[model samples]
Target: MISRRLRETAVAGPFLSVKGLVFGLFILVPFVYTFILTFQRGSLLTGMRWGGLSNYRTVVTDTLFRDALKNTLLFMLVCTPVTLVVSAAVGLLLSSSLRGMAVHRALIYLPSLLSVVATGLIWKVLLDPEQGPLHLLMLRGFGLDVPWLTNGTVAIVLLAFITAWSTCGFYGLVFMAAFNGIDTELLEAARIDGAGPWQVLVQIKLPLIQPVAQVVLALLTINCVQVFDLVFVLTNGAPGTATYTAMWYVYQNAFNGGSVAYAATMSVMLLILTALISALFLARRTGADADA
Candidate 1:
């Protein structure tokens, strides 16, 4: 029985699907190409040449890249937690058995269905100081012309929360499913024993769902690190380069600046950071399971 179970868990034979192999091949090809390019220096006009680790050296000394990395890190730090908390709140709200919740949940989830471009444009219009509904409302109601996207700190925070609002619907649905999986009997017993909603949630439901929470956190971290499109549409790293995320920097260097190889080096570094964070989460999860 143990051997059969071990075989089931093994990485060879039945564990590798044909479609998965094809998908992995597609992923692997780009990874290899990126790493190979990282070692060479070239441009659309200059063509490719073997430049060795000069790009790596450039990455080490590039102040702009440093600022971009810092911004990306800050965005991830703010966005990931905000996403998780907002997702959890949405999940908890939707997991209830109350009537009309399907419609409400769908309404809440509608943002995730829209393309990033569409949502970003929607936000752009809404944030416009003169015409944006939100801005106009703030002005009319409070007599203040709120700098919706002009200020640096406000822009980053707004970008983070807006991204969170857009993406949380799907993760929120994940949490909803997690919540739905909790045994009602335990909840009833907890209530009978005088545990309040917050206490039961804190002591029982959350602990039971730690595995799901870890997965959500890891995925959110990875997504936050690669964020670019919304930044492109919204700020374009404007108002003094305040929102230049890692991937945005990579894009700017690759296409706009025509330093594909140098950009690939940064891309590789971003990939490493993602891998390390993912491994950390997996390792922590494994250790917790072992302690259990």
Candidate 2:
């Protein structure tokens, strides 16, 4: 059988490709180093020491890691759905033929152009409990001096929503392209067959864009689970470690607590956990969608 070069090249690599060399130098090397670091103890500052499975044992019994894992999963679940919905909605709006939609689309997508750190800094200021403009407005108008980054539940939810808002721009464009690629004739046919806008959207538009939705969903799941910078900038997993995500815990150990090897172990576990989650989500969604 003739091979699909694109398919084979995608999962493997091209012959004598610069990208392949770059991938080995960057992604492959770092991952291998991190894996090696997992079985050892100590950091570069204090020097390395051999420790076989001690890091694994520590991670297994660490209550903080367990809590962080739960929070990480919760963040993924919350952020993924919100991001998908918001992005899809933005895409629909962007795809509309409304007057000045170009301006609207650009404004909608501007957030994605900013770095995550910048986004986090902006939100952190806006959500300040006392000095923030948004906080003052809410307090005066709605009489809600909500603890934006203090309380655990509120902070986690806020982070998820903010992350969604930041991500919607990029994913919105992705979906807009998907929506644009949809054939106009099918839509016209549906309308002629007495299908309303809502019906057409639900039945035709959504199903046609399922593949893009799948990709977006998987990316969201992985990114949300591995979120770090926002957590770092906003609360530093504060309010008595209320917002301690898995990556935050790992960061604490790696950078601050001087347990690089231990953090590497957590990273390895996280890598496994993320793969399992992404796979499970894809499988379940694919099965359910097929049945549907």
Model number with the top TM-score:
1
Candidate 1, 76-168: lDDT as tens digits: 889999999989988999999889999989999999999999999999999887688999888999998877678877888888898899999
Q: Which segments of model 2 are wrong by more than 4 Å?
A: 1-17, 281-292
lDDT of 2: 0.89
lDDT tens digits by residue: candidate 2, 1-292 = 2468867866665665878898899999999999999989877887999999999999999999999988887888889998999999888888889999989988998999999899998987887776888898899999988888878988898899999988899999999999999999999999999999999999999998887898899889889879998899998998888899999999999888658899999999999988997888789778977887
lDDT of 1: 0.90
Please state the error at residue 131 of candidate 1 in Å. 1.1
Q: For model 2, what is the error of residue 140's alpha carbon versus the real structure, in angstroms, after optimal superposition?
A: 0.7
lDDT of each: 0.90, 0.89
Over all chains combined, what TM-score does candidate 1 have?
Answer: 0.90
- TM-score of model 2 vs. true structure: 0.89
Displacement of residue 215 (Cα, Å) in model 2 is: 0.8
